[model samples]
Target: MTAFSAIHEEHESDKEDFTPGVEPQPTWCPGCGDFAVLKALKGAMPELGRSPEEVMLVTGIGCSGKLSSYFESYGYHSIHGRALPVARASKLANPGLEVIAAGGDGDGYGIGGNHFMHTARENHDMTYIVFNNEIFGLTKGQTSPTSPKGHKSKTQPSGSAKDPVRPLTLSLASGASYIARTAATNPRQAQEIIAEAVEHDGFAHVDFLTQCPTWNKDAKEYVPYTDVQDEYDFDRTDRREAADMMYEAETKLHEGEVLTGRFYRDEQRPSYGQEKRSTGEMPEDHLAERYFEDDPEFERVADHLIDRHK
Candidate 1:
């Protein structure tokens, strides 16, 4: 298990373990791909034997933000493009929660791009799933960072002149230790990829391709997809090979050929948490537990900080 693994009682888990007691029905439109993400995520938890209490899901503002509400876990529905910072802070504090940050393309690649890049560069111990529907589904179908060049939208009535962001390539260049892409159309693969990402020790970035039927009418349904693992042979650990594959995959997507699968993985690199601990910068004891310890030393340190600040 990685540094992020929680010390929970080992037992069998089921998909239903992630379902809330109240179980509010999903409001996503019929045939919406976000539904597939939710279903696949639920299916993945049991494979890792993770209970709801061991996980933390943080989401940014968007239709995808509703994920925090639906999933039964310690969840935070954060403001637009801010889920990463919150997830990062939580993981650093506890170092035991299985933190997962989520957001739509606009929420992540557009407004949260800087945070995403730096988090990956630092090799944060968490999984980040970006729902790449190309266009912003919420806020009335505006053009997003991942929107295809020449894509017509409410914000770009004449057609967007900017090229789509290559997420896989960006993740690799930004120093993510694990990188993968999966589409909602392939639920089994999506579930498998999510499980792998969660288990990875370093920054794991999964660019999830979802279709927005209500807004992105011209976008492909992400059907007839090619799983790179099954179809192509390459060394995922080799930066050059991974870069080549990611570039090809990014190019093919806008050209109407959908390719998805793991592109890069480097397990040897230490996660940010591990580095902090090794340097004695971060306390070995989980910070979240310190508040309940009632130790005199802890109070003395707290009082010293408060007095210094005053």
Candidate 2:
């Protein structure tokens, strides 16, 4: 099997003890955005008023994916770009769980981009946090999907010619119920936004601008977390206005002039789980049993195989 599949299989058997306390120290770089994101999520958990068992953290392959092991909750460290799908399925299976999907720009916007768009429109009751550092740190500093054009990296030594993907704008256009932006340096703001996202009833997407000191140093120096200020027209809730703000912030060339705050929140649409329950189908308490009973061919094959083995 592939290395990724092996890691996932190993993770399935490794059960972490769920104890209540401060979040464990992270293994990321000293100034990495992941540190702040982890802190923010840890701080927000108390406000959520949910037990560790009630929350589920799912993450894709990347720096942010390590978050699954840091939190004192049920966590799924899935394959690259598959965090959202696993998180969505978990939430559907147990609608009471507060599911959150975390990953880097490459994992979410590149490999998981299609799933991201569909989940937003479906309005799943979950929160998606993308740590966008513009470059792939794990792969020895390669240009990622969100890397700015002309930014030099290991993959593009002469600077990339393709324009970076604007995650906020794409999220806005994807019909996300809630959209927000924050800098990983601003722990307070990140905490607040994460709390709000968990509280949001529909699909929530937060684009967290993270700094990768190892890669994209130029961009990192340009937008130091402390340099950014929470600036946005909070009074504007119109979708068009939010879309405009997302575009401007993404395209603006000023250093540390990026806006940070909640851009959009719409609670009009019902979540997928809610809509599914409305179909009048009785919920199955024993999914495993139902699966075996509904497929006689599989059951018979399994019995025959067991008999032959015996």
What are the per-residue Cα lDDT tens digits for candidate 1 across 29-49?
887889989998999989998
Candidate 2 clash pair list: none
Residue 110 accuracy (lDDT) in model 2: 97
- Tens-digit lDDT string for candidate 2 (18-132): 3334656667887887877877887787666655666789999988888877888889999999999999988876666789999999999999999999999899999999998
- Top model by lDDT, which number? 1
In model 2, what is the error at residue 265, expressed in angstroms?
0.4
| lDDT measured at residue 78 in model 1 versus the true structure, 0 to 100 | 95
| Deviation (Å) of 46 in candidate 1 | 0.8
The C-alpha lDDT values of all candidates are 0.92, 0.78
Best by TM-score: 1
> lDDT score of model 2?
0.78
